[model samples]
Target: MTNTPSNAAREESLDLASIPPLESIPPQLGSPGGSLPAPTVDAGWNTRTKALEVLAILALAYTLFFARAVLLPFTLAVVLALLFRPVVRYLRKRWRVPEYAGAAGALVGTIAMLIVALSLLALPAEDFVRGLPEKLDAASVKLNQEKLFKSFVSMQKKLNGAGDLGVSTETPAPPRREGEDDEEPEGDDPDYAALGAAGPGAAAEVRQAGGVEVEEEDEPATMVVEERPPSLLNRVFSSAPEALGGFALAFVFLYFLLAEGDAILNNTIALLPTMAEKREAVGLTRAAEKGVSRYLMLVSAINAALGVCIGIAMWLVGLPNPVLWGVMAGMLNFIPYVGAFIGAGVVFLVAYLEPDFGLLDAAMAPLCYMCINLLEGNFLTPAVLGKSISLNPLMVLLSLAFWGWIWGPTGAVLAVPLLSMTKIVCDDVESLRPLALLLGPRIEKDDSASDSPDAESEKPAATAAPAVAPAA
Candidate 1:
């Protein structure tokens, strides 16, 4: 059959009509026919939204900083409650004791122990502080006697002499009278000219013959004005009232938290809309509580052991005030990385200051401290903490820096527990699991998963080749 131009035109019109409308087509397919999609406003993130998020974070930081007076005590209270919660629960379950009574007993016992420790260490610490100035002076004299110290002093003096060259300290010879003799009297033999032009470290030779005493340039007059700031003792005494108030507030909060923790948890969980959400919330809370409490308890025990070892080592090494050093070590050990170094440095200083200590004796104390610290940090801590509570070292450092900036020494002490809690929360939530993994210690990939039934089933689909169209 021969096709007419009218029939051909009709067929083309029908084919065009079969094509879908532009509005009906997906945006990804461009304008009806397949073409590159037009640029549209990004639905994921915009400048305004990101800016608001940044502002929100900054606002939060500002609030935390300014509100620390109230917040610090509350935070401490929460931590204490977490630490003692298991004990309270145990007492209630085993002995039929009320949570309130158990918490009170724990608090009282802890305070009493602290008071007893302070009482025992107070006299030694006071004596050490009182003798510190004399000890430091003795140490300084010893250091000055060393050849290295003398060399350094010599270098410094030479530098000073060089700096003073070309600068005249004496009064000029009355502008030299116009007709006066330029030369001095023969008897006097004045060598002022020689002294002035002789460069650095030159003394006047004429002074001895003339019986005129010349002050030695090497012996520069030093007026020592010791400006001592308030001591640690004075600072503590000054802040005693505030410290007491904070402690009282913390104890009160701690008591309430302990007494009502379960009720609070249950109420919060009950408010969730769905069973899955409630379960997630419950699991997150439980995990956080267990992890934080366990970490604190274990750390306290480890610190105590470290303190005991340090005390024994100090005693064996004949260091005075072993108990004081031990107590300080334990307290300082609460802060990570920096704390151990500080403790060791302080020990070295104290040991070096002692009159009986030789260089080797002085070195021994800090060496021992650092050795124990290394052992505890590298081996004992990791073993006890395990993978679940362990955090990435970088994240730990960042947390320490952030918290320390926010709340000083106390914040530094709390940094690890806070970081652990954050990691636990992230790990529990599906959306935050990736972040949790980032914060967590590195894990090896599981090759066994590839051999599993489900993975094997997925393999064919994942690796399958695409079907090719036959050539037209």
Candidate 2:
């Protein structure tokens, strides 16, 4: 057979004589004839490295999800105990109140207050619930009558264009008129009587006006259920037993934490084996517990004051269900931004529903929210929480979202203390020192905005205050 050297000779340097043998390559290539390119420390563009990190993070999250779901209620209780424990301690140490007695008293007081608040919510809620069906009918009619519903009309048009879902596009013929149905009983039906009682001309007019004719058996399928309780109430009552169990668990846990808080902390720390480290850990735990308790107590007072202020404002505006709106604002104020928006939404909805008020009242809802929230954010919280526990807005929002995801509304409400305790723990842990910075607030220094006069002063003329020679 003839060896095919012709194609190899035609290609670029495609010849065995032109290629260096592996053993003849340079030292870098494990030979004498060639060298390898310098290797780079690729820190950024490593796909394998990134994939590993992503997988690890996902695995950790999945593991945490199960752990959190199981222990979320306990975690919630731990945060609350931290918040309320100091009060129990103070009562015990100063007033000589028994720990168990203090816990019982606090628990009863809290529950009684919550029940009274919820009881007050019953009436307005019922009224709102009853009026919903009517409002829905009015709103539906409004879609046909008003230009404001043009947007919905467009949406409906789009929906229709997406192929029929059962509703016929062609105009449906009128149902078999009364008396046309031979199966109908020869008895009085108010609908048939009302439709048939009219004179021939009036009947024609009614038909033209779309009243049409009705069969004796044609009763409305749409039921107006006025007696039904609000879904929120129904849900609450349905879940009451399970909720009570959780509440009872939390209450019991809180009592134990209060009764043996210091002992527990000391014992845990004592197991550390080193006196200095144990002392430090014990001090840190006490500080965190005390701070959390103080914050909760102060927030309660502030929120109550805010609730009263909001209630009075609503009453002045003649808004129905003023108490609900007030309580809503007060309760939500605990969750940073989340509460403020909820309060605003309630006010807006109330104003929208009240026949006496219109768009103007609805607009005032946001303004009212802004004014109250401005006072709370700029004046109230800053003045109250002070520099000691001041979390920046970004950190607060993230904490709220994180804890809310971990638990629920209760988590959102308890986020601050949870995050605060976490921060305290992070501060104590040398390895997690950087994490404390990430979790905490940003410290912005405004040189020009300082309270000092010299910092505020503009640069003087070049002739004045020439640079002084240092130690001439």
Candidate 3:
């Protein structure tokens, strides 16, 4: 029995030796009884590298935040260039215009349109500014009368009392001398007297205490007026030269990009090592351009139409500055969900504050706006954009918040387009396809996977192969 066992062991050892080494064997043949070797994992180094990459990304984001002044205008220009590129190309090809001339013409035409739009809005804007103070005062008074404000005030008073904060709520009555009539205070009406004397170069000697100014001189005095520092808007307008310089730089960049279009593309593609990579890069670039440009153009057209409808509706409803409201609505609509709300809020406020419109009439403004937004969001956008460029609602909101934080309003405006482009690029690149899938909306599995006859037939072969492995 011992000899027999030894003989069996010797035969098994010979059989094992006859087989090739796992490394030397063809992978397909070796897989019959053995699993493929697991790939080596470097837990420490990989974690370190991942951390460094994250740090680098954070550092880049920091740099972008600080550099936004230069970057914002450039980004705007790129978007504009993309928008106008097709027109420029058409002018060059159809009209036989030189590239430089076509670029200049496109740029000038855009500027002229902007100037015309601004000119149309100037009077309305001026009127709005002139009446703003009164409107604000009225709004403040109205707000104070609201139950919410009253409750807030009461809560604050209770808190103050509990803390013994020494807050006062007293109003002292004016002293009345014997035989002095309350009606004999004509000169004490500062506003009436001030209005009567109000004109250019009119001045009064005033003593200011606790934000209240008391006029000492009733007569019109030569006012040595002290110039107040410029406001935020004023400061921005005052830096027009810097703005213009940035615009000029952007225009220059746009011109070159439009002019040397093929050369730029060729140079970019040439940087890649393999022909396949170059082709892929070119394809991705074209796809991104097509998708982004088409989206922008379609959205612009839709917004323009919405603006016209808003203008007509406001006009029919007897709203003041209908054109102004329309333009604002159209412009703000570019910002997605937030934009529509902002535009509606402005309309609601204006309507509510208007002296001519009653509460019912004022309510119509928001109602109309809401209806328009409903139609646009539910019907128009989906029908127009279709499935190709559709993005997840959560992704859209997140992109909006991210870009809004990074680049402010401009960033918010560009967020969807940029996100769409990023998704497209990710979808095209093999390694990034997973990210693209993640960004995309969820898709339900098809019945074909389970119902296919081929799949059913293959199940037995698949199970048999595994079962046969152990026996082999």
Best candidate, TM-score = 1
What local distance difference test score does each model get?
A: 0.83, 0.72, 0.79
Q: What's the TM-score of every candidate structure? A: 0.74, 0.63, 0.67
RMSD of 1: 11.7
**Candidate 1 lDDT by residue in tens digits, 1-472:** 4679889999999999998866444665555666754557788678889999999999988987888888888999998898999999999999999977888888888889989988999999999989999998999988888687799999999999888858668987767658757554333345444455553224335444674466867967789999999988899899889778877888888988998899988998899899998987888888878877888899999999889988888888788999999989898898888888999999888998998886777999999999989998889887876556668879888988999999878889888878877777776678988888888842323645776789999888766634332332
Mind giving the per-residue lDDT tens digits that candidate 2 earns over 222-285?
9777786668768889978967777777777766776776678777887897888887877777
The Cα error of candidate 2 at residue 165, in Å, is 19
lDDT of 3 at 45: 92
Q: Which pairs clash inside model 3?
A: none
TM-score of 2: 0.63
Models sorted by TM-score, best on top: 1, 3, 2
The better candidate by lDDT, 2 or 3, is 3
Pairs clashing within candidate 1: none
The total number of steric clashes, by the backbone 3 Å criterion, in model 2 comes to 8
